[model samples]
Target: MNLSEFMNTEIVAGNTLWRITGLFGLLLVGFTAGKLLKFILSRRAEQLREPRPIIAATLGAIGRAAPFLAFALGLAAGTSLLVLNGASELVGTCVAIVVTLAISWTAICLVDAPKAWMTQRAGQTESKLDDMLAPIVSKSLIATIVVLTVVQIAQILSGKEITSILAGLGIGGLAFALAAQDTIKNLFGSMVLLADRPFEVGDRIVVDSTDGTVETVGMRSTRVRTLTGHLVTIPNGELANKSIENVTKRPHIRRIFNITITYDTPPAKVAEAKAILEEIMKDHEGMDPEFPPRVFFNEFQNSALNLFCIYWYHPALWWDYLALTERINMQILERFNEAGIDFAFPTQTVHLAGDPSRPLEVGVKGS
Candidate 1:
């Protein structure tokens, strides 16, 4: 048939406009069906206290697949009608567009589904970092897939070789690397932080005296909530280079208290003081039994005998440690008072050979 006759035949047979209308109608139906399915699945899932994860996963899969399936069938029907109308080239182009769109949409939906499942599971487990990491990983995967897909689609449409494009990129590799140096460093730093797990969210850490609880970890920087109630952002690269002290992970803390008494206090009294300290340590609940407290007469100063008290306490918390130390200090004071041992303060005695009279005679000597 002639081109004009063929076109007239297609219009008369309703193959041209009918196919386009059917395609759009099917897409709308798919969207409506997907939404309804999601609602039903969500309602059913809420009925379960601890819903089986597989149920959510199945629902998510169905939700993602239903639209694509409907669209595919619609496009197939539409393309067949167009081909019957002798619009073979148009059908081919439409098919290619549908395939590309389907691939992109399916990839995005697949990425989103797993991410949602993981996020839900993480929420159930109460993991703080999951919320931050899940979106990042999901988006990164989606971005990479999109970039690759676009490149591939471009190559397919233009009939250009991908190898040539890659070769051209290789030529500019050095410049690209130079520009992305910091980005690469941060990315690697983030990976190292995740693998090593030096600190997790909510861990109290001291990095070069910037003490805080980790709030979030990102690709470029880590956020911490300081004791002073301010947020601090440290570059991941810098954080990796510095020493990190995770105080939250420490099981016990060692504490030292030094006291000095007048040198005139007898050795027997010093021994008695030590015994009293040992008793106090034993009675204190915070003291660790595995590492008992010990007191020693360390040195003799000009006016005082210095005693060292070394102990390990179950420092489960920062404030608890301070409280325990205060209790020990108060107990030590009470014990010293009861034993009549005085805590020494710096003192000086001026030995004067007729000092008061000599001060008055200074003027007479000058005369």
Candidate 2:
């Protein structure tokens, strides 16, 4: 139509062509603003070390958001030119509702961008736990966003703040709290385990009476592989309060024990035994040389003489320590046999101290 004819046409009842032109003008301005915003954000995206997929999409969404909002506002205002007296208020409320939803979704997506980037990078890491967490964290973020979005939608539709809804929860909130107590407590306990890092997967740990290697840490519990090959699951809530002995974190494994020699063993032989242990420890590469091996005549017992022995080994892997200990014990036994030194064994001597007429009474005393 010619410009004059278009200006004379009615878009809606009592809405002339000039008002329609104004709406289009507002839309054109909004479109221009959106394009400018996109150009600005594109420059920022180029500076990233590794530009993620969400960077472009998020920037695009944000760019289009302004124009979409402006267009909605202009359309709602244009409704006033219609014959309907309440059209403007109704359309404006609808526009506000739509904008609220769009804003909420955009905010959620922007927050999720970094997490998406992290998920992509997590696979490249050597840690299996981190690899597993990628999907778990992603899903968790999705669930959280969904819940928050539901709340946002509710507030927008109901036109009531969340605090007012909460205040009216009354008994329902109390019931929910009671039901979720254990879950929340366990959740916090898991957080503590993650933060404190008492032990990692594949590390041997002793908690309470249970001893095993940590297999995996889950949200509610930690799985363990025992030495006997049994799988044990301990709840994080219980684990957090337990005393954890992380064997892998130690600098050295200290070996302490008592070895007894028969009373027939001469004092010179006892000294020789100490020298033998010292020489054995010195030759072993795994043994800690900084801390000298010690063998001392601890005490004179009824059956044998006790020698207290102390030694330590570096980079304390349990298997390494056990293997070396076996070798040392065998060598000690062979040397003792060659030198005619006997290991202590339990023995007893019985004495009868009573009247001759009475039957023999056994009073047990032993050495």
Candidate 3:
């Protein structure tokens, strides 16, 4: 057969040979073009990444999604040449679904660019609000894209208007909302937490009985890494209701020290003890100028004299405060010993009516 005759020959499903060739030819061409474009964009994106990160990231995202989109488009175009009478609408609908999904997929991929940019920008700032908000915004955008994609696919498949579909979805959504009350509450609670700025990520906080460092604030729950190294997930709804103590926000740590001395010590020695403590705590390490160290002989008990001391340490760092406390205690011990002062201990004395040369006499009464 001549080339012209072969071109007109009947193929499978009554499609002419030329038409079949054209369909396959378009498919191959699309795939090849997609691959070439992806390679070029990927290389160029790499070169531009340092100078123009946002643009580079966007191009990279598109490059990653090129193959799938191009293949879907090619299939849609090729199917138009087929002579399937009743199946035409079905095929078209299927292609439309694929294309919709492809576009949505690309959109989702594109979200990565801005999401990363937001994350990078957030990291540069001192405020943690941006850090907490960036992920939420990115996830919300992706979710919106997915929902819209599903709706579009539904419209294509059912051949229904968007208004009708949305009306149906609204009724379904109401039932869903009613069924998922806790989830909704948690979502709103998360929003409240964000708005209130109660605590940020990495802040050590005490919520009710749970004391931990905030690890993450998510839609439903907040994860806390406890002191004992346990991870606790608290629902945002409940967390919002609880009182929160943000330990990380404290300006200083206050400490009250009580030093006891033996009662046998004379008034002069008691005064000296107080003076010694005042001298030992004077301008102590980590002490805040606004909250100077105070020392006084505040009380007298049966066994000892109570010396009260109050001091505030700036910055509220646990390890540094502990070191300062240890040094202060050692200094007090050394200073008191040098002054011949004895630390008080519990003791008792018993007296007898008749002992040694001492005796007791009682008067007799006649009735």
Number of the predicted model whose lDDT against the real structure is largest: 3
**Could you arrange the candidates by lDDT from highest to lowest?**
3, 1, 2
lDDT of 1 by residue, 5-40 (tens): 644454434565555556567667756775676567
Model 2 alpha-carbon drift over 4 Å, by segment: 1-140, 152-175, 350-367
The number of clashing residue pairs in each candidate reads 0, 0, 0
lDDT of 2 by residue, 1-367 (tens): 8988879787775677787677677667756775677677666655542666557546654654555555555555655444555565565567676666556556655654665566567657755456435444655665677766666666666779898765656567688879988766776687787778778677889988788888877666788898888999998888998899998789998899888888878889988876776676664757665876787788999998888888888888778989989998998888878877788988875555675755585777887
Task: Score residue 250 of candidate 3 by CA lDDT.
Answer: 96
lDDT of model 1, residue 13 = 43
What is the C-alpha local distance difference test score of candidate 1?
Answer: 0.74
Query: Could you tell me how far off, in angstroms, the CA of residue 269 lies in candidate 1 after the best superposition?
Result: 3.6
Q: Which ten residues in a row have the lowest lDDT in candidate 3?
A: 354-363
Give the per-residue lDDT digits (tens) of candidate 3, residues 1-367: 9999999899987889988998898788878888888999999999988888888889999998898888888888898888877788888888899889989989998997987798778878998888788777887899899999999999998999999999999999999999999999998999999999999988999988889999888888999999999999999999899899999999999999799999889999999988888887788778777889898898987788899999889889999999999988998999999999999978775656766666665468778
**What is the Cα-based TM-score of model 2?**
0.58
RMSD of 1: 5.9
TM per prediction: 0.71, 0.58, 0.89
